[model samples]
Target: MKKPVISGNTISIPSNQEFLADVDLFIEGVLRGYEIDESVIADIAISVSELVNNAICHGNKSEFEQSVKVCLKWINRKVEIYVSDHGNGFKFESIDSPIADENLMKEVGRGLFIVKSLMDSVDFKITPEGTTVVITKAIQ
Candidate 1:
């Protein structure tokens, strides 16, 4: 079996939210090279931004010394992205329901929901060491 090669398409960004644009640029560049459609690219961009924010705030606890790593992979008509962080992970169940009547207007609790809605699949591997969120989008 040919295992998925883990290329060095990785970026270590500061724990600042401002660097989200850098992440977007890197991701878009790679996807564009793959010849993916613009609408699909935008959806992936939104998902990446959400995950990066989570890594910086919830995963790394917003410590400037801490950094978030976003790893990218392209294989078998699918684009895979992993957003990893240094701090402990959060409970996925605790994320509020964005579409619920009470929480519909809140700015928070929408990222994860948006990610699920946009991507074909979303998975999380979390531990005390850190959290790695794997997101996949179909290119075919």
Candidate 2:
């Protein structure tokens, strides 16, 4: 499907794991609009996919009734993404070290870790409403 792009911003369904593709399409389209290089786009897309997957399965608990939301924007040569979910919120520190030698073999607990590595800045805000994780990476 041809992706839509507008002034470096886009939004789409956050319904389920399947929507990860939609997020990728939207992100890549917008990045291309700014003439961003494909390598940098891949890094941002990976970070976004990790966060969106977490929001769908962990945050929204895969509840069909609940949905995650993703918004992308660019400011001052930095790409910013906001991934929010309609489930119980969690603190940033609650996640364990997935790469620890002892935990290295685990199949999970590594999404946020990958995100932190790819983005220039990563932070979260948890409230009764939901959890919003914001990530940014500089575009050069």
Candidate 3:
């Protein structure tokens, strides 16, 4: 788990922030291959990076033994990405709104908000094994 591993459209990396750039590069490259607009690629990349960061930091708790997995797919003129981490899941509903007046000045806690704002849809799948975040954005 010292380095990122790539298998087709999926990339798995140890729970470390250093590999965030690697994930971003892989994702942006794939999006570009489909000739997606630059703005759309940036939006998707930002969302993916935010999710991956959460997977490494929050989901995996920065434990090197844990790993983060990201999978990308294109379907129906849309791009869907799934990010998973090996850790107990949390209650998504409990997250306070980032735009709330009390949370507006906080330096953290904005990742999910940003992801949801940029992507067409965001869903969470929680299981005893771990949590997975699925995000989709239309390419057209």
The TM-score leader among the candidates is 3
Model 3 earns a TM-score of 0.97
TM-score computed on alpha carbons, candidate 1: 0.91
Estimate, for each residue in 1-140, the C-alpha lDDT of model 1 and write its tens digit: 11112236887787888788878888898889989999999999999999999888888888877878889899899999999998767777887788999988887789999999999999989777788999999997
For each candidate in the order shown, give its overall lDDT on alpha carbons. 0.86, 0.80, 0.92
Work out the TM-score per prediction.
Answer: 0.91, 0.89, 0.97
Q: Rank the candidates by lDDT, best first.
A: 3, 1, 2
Question: Model 2, residue 51: what's the lDDT?
Answer: 86
- Clashes per candidate (backbone, < 3 Å): 0, 0, 0
Model 1 spans > 4 angstroms off: 1-7
Taking the tens digit of each residue's C-alpha lDDT, what string does model 3 give over 21-138?
9999999988889999999999999999999988988899999979999999999998989999987778777989989999999999988889989998999998989999999998
Once model 1 is optimally superposed onto the true structure by TM-score, how far is the C-alpha of residue 6 displaced, in angstroms?
A: 14
